[model samples]
Target chain A: DQQVKQNSPSLSVQEGRISILNCDYTNSMFDYFLWYKKYPAEGPTFLISISSIKDKNEDGRFTVFLNKSAKHLSLHIVPSQPGDSAVYFCAAKRRGIQGAQKLVFGQGTRLTINP
Target chain B: EPEVTQTPSHQVTQMGQEVILRCVPISNHLYFYWYRQILGQKVEFLVSFYNNEISEKSEIFDDQFSVERPDGSNFTLKIRSTKLEDSAMYFCASSGDAYNEQFFGPGTRLTVL
Candidate 1:
């Protein structure tokens, strides 16, 4: 099922530039959105997350913007560093009971930072 | 920081053979889950366990699959009969509460011949 989609299969950015990665979802029931970075042979590492009630959430150099009306979200990293080079995945989950809920993930986008 | 961990980094089994993947989630997390990712596909949810029972499961978690928490610190996923399509990376994750983000283990790559 293609509930969540990351259209960009790959992205390249130079050091000190802003890197923007976009994602879109077709499910309106999804109330939570998260961005994760994954390295080869490693599990996804959480970067940031935003609830549907909010439009934006920022953590240090990373910021996530959400637009409910368009069902779109984007992650922005300023002054991109080499360490940020990895595969990025966008995931969404529906609101449910007080327990672990299933997450729908998008096809990952490989981000490459060039020095 | 405490984190989730998985054993048997890689496993290879013949088709129809039984295999069990083990995991040790974060010490305080109450919710545990199993997810798998094929070589070129997005991660798919398998099942979620809580209070010694399965709280949720996806369509992919068919009759051949089972999950157990036999001990205090261990969670396991067992496949009674493996198939070629069962070759994938299995991940274990845990969340402290309903609102907290789930932490994932490194994953175990299972190859069914």
Candidate 2:
């Protein structure tokens, strides 16, 4: 299913520039949105999350903005570091029976920060 | 930090053989899940387990697939008579509760010959 989508397959930014990765979803029932970072041959690591009640959430140099009207979300990283190079995946969560909720994930966007 | 752990990082078996993938969820987590990612595809949910029973499952999870928590800490996914389409990376995940943030383990790559 294409409920969640990351249209950008890859992104490149200079070390000191701002990096932006975008995501979109067709499901309105999704109440929670999260970003995950993944390295080669490794499991995805949780980075940040935002609840539907809020439009923006920030952590350190990373920020996530959700536009409910557009059903779109974007992750921004400032002063991008080389360490930030990895595949970023966007996921959404909906309430499920007995609380064993499952996640719907988007195709990952590979972010590369060049020094 | 507490994290989910998986065994048999990689496995190769005949298409008709049965295979079991094992995982150890975080100690304090109460929910468990399995998701698979085929090459060059999005991660898809297989099933969710809670209180020793399956609470939810996806269309991808059919008669050939089953999940079990035989003990307190271990979770296992068994595929009966695997198919070539079943070759993919299987990830084990745990959350503090349903619809909560989840922690994932390094996936086990299953290759069906």
Candidate 3:
């Protein structure tokens, strides 16, 4: 059941620095990759997503880079802020029967931004 | 900014008791799903519902588990017999379409004593 994996369990960065979080997947059938941020006692919130057809997708301070050949994807947040400190999860979507799809999530990396 | 919502933020039930976790998907969304996460574990998909029927289910969604959309706005996950391993955070999500990002509701923490 380890189709998606975020090897880093925790990451720390200072304010105004770039924060990079990496994820890897073993399943090639995944059609989309997404990054989710979660806080304690809360559900995951989608931040950004990239389609398999593209190599990069960016939204404001967040950018996601995908390398299909290596089966790896990474999220970069420039000038990371304290508010960005939370558990970050990488997820992959695969289409299922009847067009229903499900997201497979990683173990999550706890990102801590120090002021 | 319509968002998914869930009820009963926390529930504690005795083993073997039945429990139902309720969720209200975003309005105009047609697809719904249930996922759960045990402490320190990855979120696992339980089932996906579409067109009033279960479109897909994972192995973890065994005979004891079921999902229903009894009303227009409400989706629910019911467990016939709660077990110790059933204690986890159950999340509900919905999407306007099948391939896009699915909005998630604040999870309901279920504890089977």
Candidate 4:
């Protein structure tokens, strides 16, 4: 069973525009959420994260909004650059299913930034 | 900036051969994890380690798989009997604290024939 889902397989945006990537999860146990960006052949790199207690968290040009009640989260990259073109994955973590628990990940959505 | 790193970048092995993938997690990090991503698939957690012991593991991590912090700076994953289905990119990650962002290594692409 997939607890985290990125319904969209791909997203494209004009350079310098805002790009929004959406994610939904079915597990109510998930309390922390994170977004990762990946280029081919490299590992996923951490972007931003938001806990269930907070509605939003922002880091530089990246912002992540979490709606706990809706079990939804979105990552927004403003003034998207060509470098931002990559695969984006949404991940979720519960407090403790096991000690030092692990994060459950979405299938990932490929984002393309058009110049 | 310190980063996690893996060795052999890519490994090719025959079926049923034992393969060991090595990782050097960031120093000062207490939590370490192993995750795998099949082509075009989500990254799935395999195991988590802390204090030289396994803290958590998924069903996918069967007896065929083992993890160890054999020394002060190295963490390793050993697959006892490789299978074609085991072919995928394996990533090693480490975090300073629980629930914090984990830094991942470039990954070791394992191809089992």
Instruction: After superposing candidate 4 on the true structure, give the runs of residues whose Cα lies further than 4 Å from its correct spot.
Output: A96-100
Whole-model Cα lDDT of every candidate shown, in order: 0.93, 0.93, 0.95, 0.94
What is the C-alpha interface RMSD of model 4? 1.7
TM-score of each: 0.98, 0.97, 0.98, 0.98
Across B1-113, the per-residue lDDT of candidate 3 in tens digits comes to 89999989999999999999999999999999999999989999999999999988999999999999999999999999999999999999999888888889999999999
TM-score of 2: 0.97
TM-score of the first chain alone, every candidate: 0.96, 0.95, 0.96, 0.96
Candidate 2 has an lDDT of 0.93
User: How many clashes show up per model?
Assistant: 0, 0, 0, 0
TM-score of 4: 0.98
The lDDT of model 1 is 0.93
Which residue pairs does candidate 3 place in steric collision? none
Which run of 10 residues does model 3 chain A get worst, by summed lDDT?
A: A93-102
Candidate 1 stretches greater than 4 Å from native: A96-100
Please provide, for model 2 over A4-26, each residue's C-alpha lDDT reduced to its tens digit, 9 standing for 90 to 100: 99999999999989999999999
Tens digit per residue, CA lDDT, model 2, B1-113: 99999988998999999999999999999899999999999989999998888988999999999999988889999999999999999999999888668899999999999
Cα lDDT for residue A80, candidate 2: 96
Clashing pairs in 1: none
Let me know the TM-score candidate 1 reaches against the reference structure: 0.98
Residue A58's lDDT within candidate 2 is: 99
Q: CAPRI band of model 1?
A: medium
Q: On residues A1-115, what C-alpha lDDT tens digit does candidate 1 reach at each position? A: 9999999999999988999999999999899999989998888888999999999999999999999999999999997999999999999997564544877899999999999
